[model samples]
Target chain A: MNATLNKPTSSTDVAQNGANRVNYVTPLANILESKDGYVLEAEMPGVNKDGLEVIVENGELTIVGRRAVAENRGREVYRESRAFDYRRAFELDPSIDTTKITAKIDQGVLTLHLPKAEAVKPRKITVG
Target chain B: MSIIRYQFPQVPNWSSSDRLASLRDEVNRLFDFSWPSRDSGLFSGWSPALDVFDDKDNLVVKVELPGLNKDEINISLDKGVLTVSGERKQEHESKEGESFRSERYFGKFHRSVTLPATVDSTKVSASYKDGILTVDLPKAEEAKPKQIAVNVA
Candidate 1:
């Protein structure tokens, strides 16, 4: 469970300019474990449905959210929010049923449901 | 023109780190008031972070408030001060499952900023998209920067 948290992207993997390297911030995430499986929720404040992607590959889950920068807004008098994208990866457990995983985004929050594999679920045996 | 590389360390929160973070933010806010360029606010619940920008015609303010319904937000401008207040409620309450991690903030939040220039209050427009609230306040005609021509002797 510890390994399934936020994972940062390596600098080498991105196309970096001398001055501009795409910045990525790990979105705040919550994970819940139930008898069925795990529920993961992430907060990506500026991302829209068109800019979100969730991929599962090689027993790993990755979520990337792109924030569209509005240009020509003018000279900034004050700033607290930074212009950055969101990226987080998680190493999926073998017991998770990747095929049954589901994801949805609403109001910049992403919720993912990862169900456990049938063979991994606890089953009660009856006397013959 | 430049991309910023900002990455936060990935720390597992076996403890209540969210409370610690909010406490740190409060401390920062206390010190931040000395610098007008960086001011969030001192609110009881949570305060949403915002940015202020001014072009020739308009002053644009953007606030980050995620997972909130449109009706939950309230915006008002009085005497050159713009205030944005909102409430973000948790979507669901579950008792059947156990939570491993919870990091998102849910509560009422309020933020206000005094405009640098006078704006046409009637023409102010606001829009909420992708969990971001953008308030566009058009500067008054008299407050716009005027260019003067000088004749060379």
Candidate 2:
């Protein structure tokens, strides 16, 4: 019984390449798989929507943004830890429909939705 | 001014301005320095948001700024030092929950970077679109790097 359920899981793995090297130097990201698509969540602490860029070029996805240092022209200062920039990139798999991928930056977190191709989506067949 | 004296052990007297200056220095040391080496609190992680590429006569700096208001951002170049500064504010309430998980950063931040060579500040152009700030710094005619070819006789 376990073998039957595992058969489909093995094929899904073949369709996805999860071997992208994680860059610890930048923000940490979490990838989630759903019934219809995959979601990517990146933690961009000081970044805002205006500072973020999501680009799909040459079949690769890249996210870039920066957090500016606060102006203290003539003011006194205290403990500080503001960072300059945030940049990350990922090579996409062929199973993902690049044209259908959508990205939204809300707050400092960037969320990307990559919809699987119709042929790759799981479907239940009916026999009359 | 009313003077109240309280005796403490091993306490040195410091002037008000001196104390304030020291405090300011401490804050600057903590927040206004170079890119952070590690991720700490929100806005504390460092990444090269701006990648500057120089080719002969032109210099391009691509800056990444997300969710920041245009009016709040200021970019200026004076005496060869390029300064970028802005502020971000936190929201008062949230529907997620009374105790919320906030990874977003809010407050002021500034970065001052010196240019590689003399640039024509008047000819500089900056455009912010799609959450990226691209600053074009045109180099002076004499400052552009010249390619020298070697001839073997």
Q: What is the TM-score of each candidate against the true structure?
A: 0.76, 0.44
Clashing pairs in 1: none
State the C-alpha lDDT per candidate: 0.77, 0.56
Docking class of 2: incorrect
Candidate 1: regions farther than 4 A off = A1-22, A124-128, B1-44, B149-153
lDDT per residue, candidate 1, B1-153, as tens digits? 111112223322113464466567667776756644432435325656678999999999999887788889999999999999977887777687777776676677788888999999999999888888999999999999999899999
Consecutive 10-residue window with the lowest summed lDDT within model 1 chain B: B1-10
A58 in model 1: Cα distance from truth in Å? 2.9
TM-score of 2: 0.44
